[model samples]
Target: MATGWAGDGAVQDQIDATVEDAVKRARNQLKKGPGLTHCEECDAPIPAARREAVPGVRLCVACQSAHDEEAAFSGYNRRGSKDSQLR
Candidate 1:
């Protein structure tokens, strides 16, 4: 479903790349290390389960959801990443 100069599936490829980019970001956080016992922003007690589940997590579930939403709004369009390859 490529819509630009790229051949078929370019759009889908970009989508997959975008998803991969997000997953990488989350994975990078894990690589850093687990977060503190309390929430970084609110100081709420972080559950042991969450801490064990996702290392290097900064925000609690509620805060993380908000943070993710904000990040989604801030993401730059990657259309050029593919189009640039054409040249």
Candidate 2:
């Protein structure tokens, strides 16, 4: 538990902060307001079923898939691991 310069429970604190930040980011990203009939990014027609299924949806299936892929590879290292810090 001796973390040198860091206080007790510093690692846990960092983990908790990372989780909270991710939660906040996800909540903030939730689409709000009315759903768009056309994809905002590609101008493709958004299916009615999709619009109803996901309220406030702005992007079509393909565009949303691409966006999700980009988001998945954000490469954010919030844990502050020694290895990552060293690099």
Q: What is each predicted model's overall lDDT from 0 to 1?
A: 0.79, 0.91
For model 1, the local distance difference test gives: 0.79
User: Compared with the true structure, what per-residue lDDT tens digits does model 2 show for residues 12-44?
Assistant: 999999999999999899887779999999999
- What pairs collide in candidate 2? none
* Prediction RMSDs, each to the true structure: 10.3, 7.2
lDDT of 1 by residue, 1-87 (tens): 436878788778999999999999987765457667888898888898998887776778888888888877845556778766666
User: lDDT (0-100) at residue 80 of candidate 2?
Assistant: 88
Local error of candidate 2 at residue 65 (angstroms): 0.9
Best by TM-score: 2
